[model samples]
Target: MYKNKYEPALDIYRRTLDNQLKLIHGDHRDIAASLSGISWALGYIGHTEEALEYSMQSLAIQQRCTPSYHPMLAHTLRAI
Candidate 1:
């Protein structure tokens, strides 16, 4: 749904991302979710390398802050 409605959905997602990033700009682990959003959007836009890079970055951050078996960590791992 979102992938097909990029123009409209993107603003909403971008706003959400801005808010979250504002709260945890330098906290890589805390901003894993936002990073995931970026990766998702990049993937939807066909930027495979950028998407994978962001996914890996998010995965690394989550691994550092959460347990290895955490749900978000799992998602990030699979995404990469």
Candidate 2:
């Protein structure tokens, strides 16, 4: 279930973000996704403001990718 993903996904996002500066940079796509994931994690951990921030970031990317209301973007919004 998605709820279950909250933990591990958050862990991975955190790890990636932590090592991001040293490991890689220049692409906001993955970073945006990571931030969004972290936002969701923060939301799951009870940080709504942060979660909304991440969700909006992801939403921006999703809109650029889809440019319309696709199933994926819909789901992402629903998640928020």
Candidate 3:
């Protein structure tokens, strides 16, 4: 999705992320990664508000679950 710049990729990312969240348990780092991808896709597709919500969710998860200096958290912070 990030590499190709395709708008339809947002829908695919959204569906996959939703399914991932349902299957994953607890505060998993993989969920955060999925959220970040969804947020990025939303932003690219011009859904700025939804993007921000997902970004915030991803950041919150990272802050709660990952190390303070984790690269994933840093990446999400940059996105926000």
Candidate 2, residues 3-77, lDDT tens digits: the string is 556778788888987786456555445565676678878887787987887788777877776646567577677
Tens digits of per-residue lDDT, candidate 1, 1-80, equal: 43476445446666776787777656566578867877877788788898898788788788778887799888887787
The reply for model 3, stretches above 4 Å from the true place, is 1-5
The worst-scoring run of ten residues by lDDT in candidate 2 lies at 21-30
Can you tell me which runs of candidate 1 are displaced by over 4 Å?
1-3, 7-22, 25-30
Candidate models: Cα lDDT each: 0.75, 0.73, 0.86
List candidate 2 stretches off by more than 4 Å: 1-9, 17-32, 67-69
Scored against the true structure, residue 64 in model 1 reaches a CA lDDT of 78
**Candidate number of the best TM-score:** 3
How do these models rank on lDDT, best leading?
Answer: 3, 1, 2
* Candidate 3 vs. true structure, TM-score: 0.84
Estimated TM-score for each candidate: 0.73, 0.60, 0.84
Enumerate clash totals for all models, in the order shown. 0, 0, 0
Candidate with more favorable, higher lDDT: 2 or 3:
3
Q: Clashing residue pairs, candidate 2?
A: none
